[model samples]
Target: MTSDATASPAGKIALVTGAARGLGVEISRQLAALGAHVIVAARDRRQAEGTAAALRAEGGSASAMKLDVTSEADRLAAREAIEAAHRRLDILINNAGILIDSPDGGTPAERQPSEARESDLRRTFEVNFFAPLRLTQTLLPLLRRSEAPRIVNVSSIRGSLTHLSDPTSPVYPIRALGYDTSKAALNAFTILIAEELRGTPFKINAVHPGWLRTGMGGDRADMSVEDGAHTAVRYATLGDDGPTGGFFFLDERLPW
Candidate 1:
């Protein structure tokens, strides 16, 4: 394990999953800019390394790691690597997620809850819900070693139950059952874990990065990747007085 003096100046270490492209890439960049030694983890090692190289070229501290969150072997390897290097992790951003049933391309012309397949649901849950929960559990020990640990689950506003049920809600008319439900489960996990660690220095919360013009959000999205990344970056670097077990978009708390 590396000594404290060898760690980042802030003594902060961050690991971002699916950091090769899109919002994950932007999130990694922003975190690195804040002086955190960022780990740009992705299933593809080459892509991950490329992202890390770019960050380093821009004068930010970053490195690459191969991590397929859905694979147990990869998860164990990631834990071992972190333990061997930093010995502690200050921030964990679960930004890796999938949208298999996106409306951009649907068999029935529009993706709907009624027409969603079981396979799609299971696959979506595997990445969005289970992977984050398992990774957090696996890394909890390292996180405990930090003076102030922060876990930011990158969720979506579509997971909001209130918004989904209300007729007036913008997302009420559009339903991507698999993706939305998985994120809702992730939000629940955040709340449960935060409550379990309530009195501790750990701050766990879910943030809805606005619908950005990423591959998942599609070209019609109103926000840019940089704009979408701000919320997660803010929460990931939160102070000791920051709120936990909450759902937020920027500074506003959203309905569960």
Candidate 2:
């Protein structure tokens, strides 16, 4: 760890899961640049360290945490470490996700909604929905310690059931059953969590980070990694007056 302070000038402590590459890296960098001591956590320790080091190199306070969001051991270890080191957590960006089904919609037989493998759907939920929900639950103690705790669930437009039903929406045809439904579950989690913490200082919301050119987004995505991270970072750094239990893309409120 660096000799610098554990908390940033903003006096905020943030943990960003899947912080090794793409939007995760960009989100970490943005938060670190804003003087929030960012914990770059990923399944790969080395990659997380690299991200933390890069942030430090850019004159930001950061630390690396090896975290596989799906692992119970990792979730507990992260909570313990944060409690010991920072005592409180101000921000958490649940950004790790997977897209196992065909992005080209359910044109193919096996990839179709009716024929998609249950195993793949289950795995997607484990990573995209269950992992974040469980991790947040595990870290609730530390979050309660903060004056203002922000939880940003990095969701997708594909998760919008309204849009999914609308033939006019761009993603209406791009139905990856596993990926889409997993995010929908995440959205539900966000709403329920926020409802539970409504009068409190916690602000929890799901973010739709637009189509971006990342590993999951593929080469033809319309946005960049930086652009993809904007909404998540926005929700992560929201003020006490900000809205919660909502899905957002930039300033626009998305349909649940």
Summarize candidate 1's per-residue lDDT along 1-256 as a digit string, tens digits.
1122122325489999999999999999988887889999999999999999999999999999999999999999999999999999999999999988764411222556778889989999999999999999999999999888999999998889998899897777668898878989999999999999999998899999998888888887889999999888888877767789999998889999
* Model 2 regions lying over 4 Å from their true place: 1-9, 103-110
TM-score of each: 0.94, 0.94
lDDT tens per residue, model 2, 1-256? 1112122327699999999998999999999888899999999999999999999999999999999999999999999999999999999999999888865322322367987898999999999999999999999999999988899999998899999899998888777889889999999999999999999988899999898888878777888988888778788878756888999998889999
Candidate 1 ranges with C-alpha deviation above 4 Å: 1-9, 103-111
Candidate 1 global CA lDDT score: 0.88
Q: Residue pairs in steric clash, candidate 1?
A: none
Residue 160 CA displacement from its true place in model 1, Å = 0.6
